[model samples]
Target: MGDSASRSRVSYPVFQDVNHMVIFGFGFFLTFLKRYGFSSTGFNLLIIVLGVQCSVLIEDLLIFLLQREDENSLKRITNAVVSMTAVVISTGALLGKTNPVQLILMTVVEIIVFHMSRWINETFLQVPDNLSMTHVHLFGAYFGLAVSSRFSEPLPRSEKNASTPKSDLLSMLGTLFLWVFWPSFNSVLAVDKSKAIYNTYFALAVSAVTAFLLSVLTTKDGKFRMTHIQSAVLAGGVTVGYAGHGIKYPWIAMILGLLASVISILGSYCLQRCLNPALKIHDSSGVHFTFGLPGVLGALAQVVLTVINNWTNSARQGHLVTVHIGAFCLTVSVALITGFITGLILNLKLFKTIPVSKYFEDQLYWEFPHLAVGF
Candidate 1:
């Protein structure tokens, strides 16, 4: 028993140490890239890519935490909490200037836009049958970044599925490293470095706290389940895109955070039913697209609202409505065309090698032994 205990203790710290090393390496690489004359635009683009990747990684972490128990869950929880706490504490200590009001307002705007987009997608646009708001948001963020960076299509589903324990572990390391440098990414070109630093740190703190509390409260069977926290964090982050430029109200951010969380929960519940009449898919291994109609509509709704906002903002700034409309139309057209081309490209070659028959056979053999022969 003593030996076992010693081994257990050593294992966790070793895992943590490895995680730190990976993070350090990644940070050094990014720093080196910056020092080697990488453009400011390149740095911004890197942040956007890394941020979306981190978002996906965080989602995976939540799922892992939920699926694990005892020491595994505890270890995951400790890592998440400690990493976030370190970010918040260090930011507070290092950069103490921030606008609380602007922060709050930005948070609220983000939450509202996020939920509104989900609502719109659920109500209209038949894109797919099983897409969730979270998925849609992720797609939008990734899609947006891809457009901004002029990259090829996003990572394929097969590649994502092939992710293993080691890769996932590396992803967590990546997430923490991103968290540490988020302020720079968010505010790199800002005239007010002080405010940018403060806002970025504050948002990170809120996201971490919100994620932790939600994990604890919403988890079932020792697994970290999805909750309103996901939406809240995304909404808060997106809101920063706009609100960060305006007022920095913490209360507004908190209110937005709460609203986003509630709306995400309610919207997901309602849309899950509407879009998934057969309810064949489970959220256990990630949302399946076979039942993703409502999710498509949700995505459309978000697109519409964003269009309207852009139009209004541009008009207010005395730009031609045609320009705004043209821009929106161009963006949508490009996204659709690019997404299609990329999806096709990715589906070629080895992507087609994932034998569906084999997968189904394995599922029958292992997941439903009693029903494998149609008992």
Candidate 2:
């Protein structure tokens, strides 16, 4: 028992860090609405708790049935919580628009699909580590977008969807938590923790600097937009998700960080406006810019590095390249399709969807003091 406890204690730091990211980090990250603060954090808490329970059961059951083996309880729980991170990302897209019931249903369904996709990627494609980026980040972002595309209600002229100074400040706290702990997130399943941490730390540092610079340049009055800082600043962390473990040089990580920040800032500031009309996706939290694109960039970086290594070593690892490409394509297709179908189910009249007038408001879900309500 003492030996078992000692082994468990060794993994505690990473588990604690990931737990913080999933709860406090993501919970506060969603609290950016002027009036929807209660729902944002409250519903997020709901989804996460349920995800932790449901994901573990699903993952364990799948492993038992398919592989006829059981995984360590701690490892399964940790991965389950990490899987919830993707569900939280998806929740970000449909934030103010979804009712609690819809959110709960989405959480349950997404977890099943998430694990299924993960199994396929790891087992069939033989791309185990890469699933962290493709299955979680890429899958989460596109899944949310697919669901968003299915529900096309326009924000009413009177809707209180814009963030206030206080709300944005709270949201920044979430961003800081994610930023400080993201190296742990990127390096959680890595073979070499030191290399992963080194690359991720540099990448995130440069990404933060680049986000600030781009935020200033993009805005007319040279002011940093809270939105960019909250979202784009984390792109570097996402950029190193898959490649961090393999990245040897700090410079390469820095360059990837620079590129990721540019793409995130541009996508958030420019492409985001075009999403509704062009793709019919109403991503409430810009997850595509922050998680989806940066994740793909990270996965591509891994592929490129693999090709270069093959060339230099005179080795033919075409199978590896095929795995990366196949994993990417398969992840996109599964996430979007499953998400769209889930949206369609949630939209059924039985679900009792939120009315348009109540969008982004806390009154529908939370109780406030009479004095606060009057104000």
Candidate 3:
């Protein structure tokens, strides 16, 4: 009995407190960075990020709050309030802006950010642990890459199907609220009106076309399907982001985005099928390290794309070829090092901690009885 009790104690919830602390610390650091670099543009971007974060939190909070009541009615109320607030704020801010074009551009960017955030939260946080990490990561990567493709996939029934039409309407309104704020998130930084317009429309067009194609090819049953269009959009966007200012080859952006989307989907599938089973770990959280690997790859891709574009442009202009090699190297090195250190700190539990509530256990049983068996 004593030995059995000790073993049970050892297995009891050791990670929750640590996980909470790491998340809060990360949020604090992000907040600090934003404030330190505060400017009109920076402030707006920070708000946009915060808005995305808040949107998720609000949804979760509303659902939790309504769980004991009429789930349908409470959900409807939550959606309505969230949607109204978003619409009011966005409309007010854009009104009387110096450049209507800039406002419109910012709105589009905000929509992308909003969608990415939702996709990450849903694919990573909401799913059962039995689902492999590769599955979650692939979902997230493809979703992000799909942004450049400009496609509108249907919301998951889990996300969209509420108890009532009113609830569904509210949920959609909240989504639209996100759509309205998206463009402003990044486009506010663009100095040239023409460039801003081009970037905004271009991103939207790519995303829309990719989404449309996916919808056409996908079966009516709504099973998620991977395609090359998603990769093309992401790669294209990354390429354009690196050198769009100087390069006239906007098509390069689309091509690269398409390629990235394909690679991301295929890589994720391969990782899940080939690598995950061998490791014996299921669930995305268990494979957190794998998810982060793409960020490193993305940084490298950005560097290579930027250098090539710069070199090509410089050759055409016959400019003195003094590269800011030190600055570029330092930036990438610092970013990589910082990311590594941060991951280590979180894993090591060098910061504060939080305790998962016992109440959550009941929730696990109620919402996912089968999953509750494993816990």
Per-residue lDDT of model 3, residues 205-229, tens digit only: 4643554455344446655332223
- What is each predicted model's overall lDDT from 0 to 1? 0.35, 0.86, 0.32
Off by more than 4 A, model 1: 1-169, 222-235, 256-333, 348-375
TM-score of each: 0.39, 0.95, 0.36
How well does model 2 score by local distance difference test?
Answer: 0.86
Candidate 1, residues 1-375: lDDT per residue as tens digits?
787667567546544543443244232222211111121112223333343344335535535765723344334433332222211211111111112222122222222333333334434433221222223323332222222222122223422223334434443443455555545433433445466556546655665566556556555655553333323333333333223323355554444334333344445556457743343222211112111222233333334444555665754433333332333343334433543343343334543323322221123112445655766
Task: List the candidates ranked by TM-score, beginning with the highest.
Answer: 2, 1, 3
Candidate 2 runs further than 4 Å off: 129-134, 156-158, 313-315, 371-375
Q: Cα RMSD (Å) between model 1 and the true structure?
A: 20.3
Tell me the tens digit of each residue's lDDT in model 2 across 1-375.
Answer: 887678678888899999999899999998988998998888888899999999888866877787857766777788888899889999999989888989999999998898888788877887774354435888899899899887866564554878888999999999999999999988877888899999999999999999999899999999988898888889999988877888889999999999999999887756666765687677788898989989889879988988877875544568778888889889889999999999999999999878777777888878887748457
What is candidate 3's CA lDDT for residue 63?
53
Return the clash pairs for model 2, or none: none
